[model samples]
Target: MIYQTAESINDGRAFLKIDEFIKNNSVYVKIENMNPGGSIKIKTAIALVDAAEKNLDLKNKKHVIESSSGNLGIALSIICAARKYNFTCIVDKNTLPHTIKVMKAYGAEVIIIETPHPERGYLGARLDYIKKRLVSDNSLVWTNQYESSANREAHARLTARELLNEFPVIDYLFIAAGTTGTLMGCVQTVTEATPATKIIAVDTKGSVIFGTPSAPRYIPGMGASVLPPLFDSKNLFDMVQVSEKETVQTCRLFARRYGFLVGGSTGTVLTAIRDYSPKIPAGSVVVMISPDGGERYIDTIYSDEWCLQKGLLQLQSSTSRNTFSGAVVE
Candidate 1:
């Protein structure tokens, strides 16, 4: 059954299911999808724009420009549309179709850049181009999501506060590291409230986050080739590197088991949880953050044929039937 409930940003009671998961295992999981924008980026988007407005004279600003993989762009587009500010997003060539459509629907101009390398895909190049353009046009406000302190602050204030209130006794948190804002925010909050709580950061195998080799990542939101300035690795107790295959399998499992169609990064978190579960003391708790929903990846990870073509699904010789190796478990 689809768990339908009115979403609330301020209500701690609404997150009881997540809290129960934390309590049962001895850890707390904070689902930031409850944010108004359908992802944790909503917190960052609000803070980024608000900070820009406060720092710069916005009375006659012409446009707000930013480079993003998907969610952050969508959030910024919505904020700009509602505030009547012209917004422009420079996204990678491979950005999801639905994400592009949603940004356009919000009256934001979308610029898709074909990145030189198929792997890096315009995140850095597009930002460099935008910065150059901003130099010429002083009216444009550049909201650099990766290096933005406001993004980190949003997670620290809103997401962290909600988690602490919902699971006061949380002992460990497993988070997929993207731009590092969410993890950094959680780290800051947990350090202040529950000093003993341990934070485990998860990254993809190909991501250069922990000085790993750079490889193309199928998963869009999490993992970065370059260490994001916002990531304070010292605060994290440990880090786990999840493979793309594991991420895809976990996402499918979450859908089948809990009826939660989460995205790739969420799958990585789940994989880490399973890998680390046995080591956790029996009475201790563990919580993982699922960053976004799976509707955006309908033609990709959520599709069986797509899975087969990607080698994420294989045929069993005995039965002559295709089956996924990673079965769903609640």
Candidate 2:
């Protein structure tokens, strides 16, 4: 298989018209899942590492550590392996089994935090562990994806440029918010390049990013118990929150209609698009950024047993699917 350099993987991805899934002719989906690391997190991961190298933060540090649910951890693992640096990923229990295995396969040490923070839950606990480790180990460097400026910089410099190049006249840009890196980065770039374009931030209902109450969440890539530093509401054109059940339903719809299996976060984006479609003007171009594919979620979002256990099995209804229709833009 042909591959781009880790530093330039952003060049390898392209937008695919998932109009059939959107049931709208003008909407387009950028499948960031095609990134070698399996998610858009690869962009920020490379940016963070590059920044560290430039700042001499990794001068004497042979060990790199970061707190992540999945995607970022795997991205770092891949980068560390290619750069000949040791990597340690501190993850919460909600992280999928396959994600940990992938990180390990790339020569990363995985640390699972069993306990959840009383207020912030798993994310807090994971961050707390990294802080403690950082104090004791002078050689351990943390990427700090949550608060790192480089996180947002990567998306602005790489991702946003790609989107604008593909569709220079975007009317709406729909993005899922995680650590707010992707959201903030793209917003910064898009708002400046296409001032008339609307940028919608799609977050999970239980996420605290938009000042919502935090709850136990099973989905990995998006939604955070604590507010991310990069999140800036003033820049967003609008915000939409989708329930986990709705997210799963959308994922199921994509699987049945498009033969595509997208992650929980991508499902959230799709759900937002459907809910917000009526308000969107006709003939306007809409672009949704899908962070990753659903392959890693086969045990969770795509599993019948898992859905049943979570009381989400009944959410799979075909009635809602009947309301939609489109054609692929070949």
For lDDT, the strongest prediction is 2
- Worst ten in a row by lDDT for model 1: 1-10
lDDT of 1 by residue, 45-138 (tens): 7788877787765546957999888888988887787677899998876578889999998898998877644554445677667878889999
Look at candidate 1 and give me any clashing residue pairs: 25-285, 26-284, 26-285, 27-285, 27-286
Using TM-score as the measure, which candidate wins?
A: 2
Clash numbers, per candidate: 5, 0
Q: Which stretches of candidate 2 lie over 4 Å from their true place?
A: 1-7, 20-24, 315-330
